[model samples]
Every structure is written in structure tokens, then in C-alpha cells.
Target: MKISKQLNKLKNLNVEAEKCSTREEAKKIINKANKAQSKINK
Candidate 1:
């Protein structure tokens, strides 16, 4: 949570990539998100 909060300090960072219009793109985003969450949970 603290690491994520610090990342929020970056003004250009886009945490919510909600503009995915393709299935492939969406899958890539979902996979990346899961990977990140797993790392944080560990």
C-alpha cells in the first residue's frame, strides 16, 4: 500500500488502464495486474 501510494506521486502515471479496446490488449492488462498483485502479496 505504501509503495503504491508513493507511485501516486507521479502525475503521469496511469494506474487504471481502462481504454483497452481489444481482447488481446485486455488480456495483457489483466495478466500484468495479476502479476503485480501476486508480487505485492508475497
Candidate 2:
């Protein structure tokens, strides 16, 4: 259940990243999502 929630959060982050107008902003969001994903994997 927690994992699913985290996945949903990641999905939202992806969406947010897509909406970002700047490459730097998008990169930041993607990096944040990647960190969250790594935590989930562990």
C-alpha cells in the first residue's frame, strides 16, 4: 500500500516535471523522483 502511494507520488512528480518550463526545473524534479524510486527499490 505504501509502495503504491509512493508510485502515485512519482507519477505526480513526472507530470509536474513535464509541466516545467525550464530544463533545470525538470531535471530537479526528475532527480527528486529518482531518489524516491531508489528508496522504494530498497
Candidate 3:
């Protein structure tokens, strides 16, 4: 359940990041997502 929930959250984040018009904005979103994902791994 937790893994599925995290995957769903990541999917939503990717969708939202794709909507970003600028590279900087997309990078920020990706970095934030990576940080959150790393925490889960730890």
C-alpha cells in the first residue's frame, strides 16, 4: 500500500512537472521529487 501510494504521488508529480513551461521549474520539481524518494529509500 505504501509503495503504491508513493508511486501514485510520484506519477502526479511528474505530470505536474511536465506542465512546467521552464527548464528551471521542471528541474526544481524533479530535484524535490528525488529528495523525497531518497528519504523513502533510506
Give all candidates' CA lDDT scores.
Answer: 0.55, 0.86, 0.80
lDDT of 3: 0.80
- Residue 40 of model 3, lDDT score: 67
Highest TM-score scorer: 2
Query: What is the lDDT for 26 in model 3?
Result: 87
Q: What is the lDDT of residue 42 in candidate 2?
A: 78
The numbered model that scores best in lDDT is 2
The per-prediction CA RMSD against the true structure, in angstroms, equals 4.7, 1.7, 2.3
Better of 1 and 3 by lDDT: 3
How many backbone collisions does model 2 have? 0
Candidate 2 regions off by >4 Å?
Answer: none
Off by over 4 Å in 1: 5-16
The TM-scores, one per candidate, come to 0.60, 0.75, 0.63
- Model 1 TM-score, 2 decimals: 0.60
Q: Give the TM-score of candidate 2.
A: 0.75
Clashing pairs in 3: none
Q: How close is candidate 3 to the true structure, as a TM-score?
A: 0.63
The digit string of per-residue lDDT tens for model 3 on 1-42 reads: 466666777888899887999999988889878976875676
